[model samples]
Target: MTKTVEFYFDLGSPTTYLAHTQLAKICADTQSELIYIPMLLGGVFKATGNASPAVIPAKGRYMFQDLDRFAKRYGVQLRFNPHFPINTLILMRAATGIQLHQPQRFAEFVDCLFRALWVEGRNLNDPQTIAAVLTENGFDPEEVLALSNDESVKAKLKENTEAAIKRGVFGAPSMFIGDQLFFGQDRLDFVEEALRQD
Candidate 1:
């Protein structure tokens, strides 16, 4: 049986970047289909009474070191973008729009965006930067940007975020196998286990 897993993500999250970096292997091993669900983490947090890990004193302190260790262990480059906690609304909307228009292009664009933010310290909120990233990824930047602001695309982004909140998603990189929700990059092992059982 082919298992289907829903991946809820927001680009502002480092953990989401981490999960994106590692999920391909798990999907290959388990033969599970990944249903990409992009949502605004800010909306999820507001609706679910949740906050970022960086807001917690203890966890905030540990997260930096944890990210470093995880990066080294996974051999993934990790650059702390000066624009930490970036305004991801536009990015998420653009991504959703791209996915709606061109699925394959969406994946490539996302990979580039993630690397730009988490591996190269790029400012994702800037239009020029995002355009450069998309262009470098072989996407037509102007077309994607045009669709990004379309009413329908904007509506999808809003709907996705609202649905995520209603689904009890309070953070980034959350995976859902049916109704079982696994939060965090560390919880991906559990997500794989759930897929195995399925």
Candidate 2:
């Protein structure tokens, strides 16, 4: 059977964006399948009582520096979003909805959002900016927003978040190969190692 890596992510996370950049290549190198799971980081934090490193003054400062190092090492563009702590409820819902309804465009949605917020450092917290970004990327912003309010889509996102919390997830960029959970974009080496194992 082909190995599958379940990536639990929220677009608000720079680390998740960094991880997203590398996961495809890792999966390809290992002949593994990459599954994107859109879960709300806020919900995970509330449930697990875990918070972002940005909440700490010192950690937040050093975290970005470290993330920059990783981005450089990965040869990917990663700019810190000035609009830190973007509420990703609507965005993750759009991701879940796209994964459920327009499966083909799911990756496209993920890519645009990640690049908009992380690579280009757009302020996605604003509705107008979000619409403009979506439009620029050829996505109908109103349509995508409508999908966010879909009952089924909302329920699926909640379910994914609940399932992640139950599996000991406390933050974004959490990856699971079989039952082994690897948290943090920094842990991709372990994830890759797991993929190569039984």
Candidate 3:
């Protein structure tokens, strides 16, 4: 039987960026179907009473160091965004809109936004900056913005967030192989193993 991995993610997460780098290769290796579910990290936190590790000083310090090691190991660029904690509400809404309407461009959207925030450390919080990034990537900023603002798109994002929370997701990069939940980019090895077992 073919296996599947339901990847619930929020683009705001640096760890989710790391997971983005590896999950594709793992899925290809295992021949598993990868489904991307864009969710709101802030919403997840609010619903589950969980907070980012960055809320803690020492843990945040150690988290970055650990992330750097993983990035090197994975050979992916993961620079610290000066604009850490990007309000991903709109970004994720845009992503979800793209995923829903322009499925072909979904991967491009993910790559562009993830690279902007995580690799190039671009500040996505600014509207002009986001527009510029979209233009540079051959995306129509006005169209994307309009799509994001659609009531259905907004409601879909909310629904996705709620569904993720209901599925025991409290953070970004939560992967589910069937009923098993594997949270965090660090748990990807287990994800691969799970796929193999299936």
Per-model lDDT: 0.87, 0.95, 0.95
Give the alpha carbon lDDT tens digit for every residue of 1-198 in model 2. 999999999999999999999999999999999999999999999998889999999999999999999999999999999999899999999899989999999998899999999989899999999999999999999899999999999999999999999999999899999898999999999999989887
Ranked by lDDT, top first? 2, 3, 1
* Clash tally for model 3: 0
lDDT of 1: 0.87
Which of the predicted structures, 1 or 3, would earn the higher TM-score when compared with the native?
3
- Candidate 1 residue lDDT tens string, 70-149: 88988899987888879988888889998998887778878988999999899988889888888887888788878888
Q: What is the C-alpha local distance difference test score of candidate 2? A: 0.95
Model 1 misses residue 176 by how many Å? 0.2
Locate the minimum summed-lDDT window of 10 residues in model 3. 189-198
Q: Please list the residue runs of candidate 2 whose C-alpha ends up more than 4 Å from where it truly belongs after superposition.
A: none
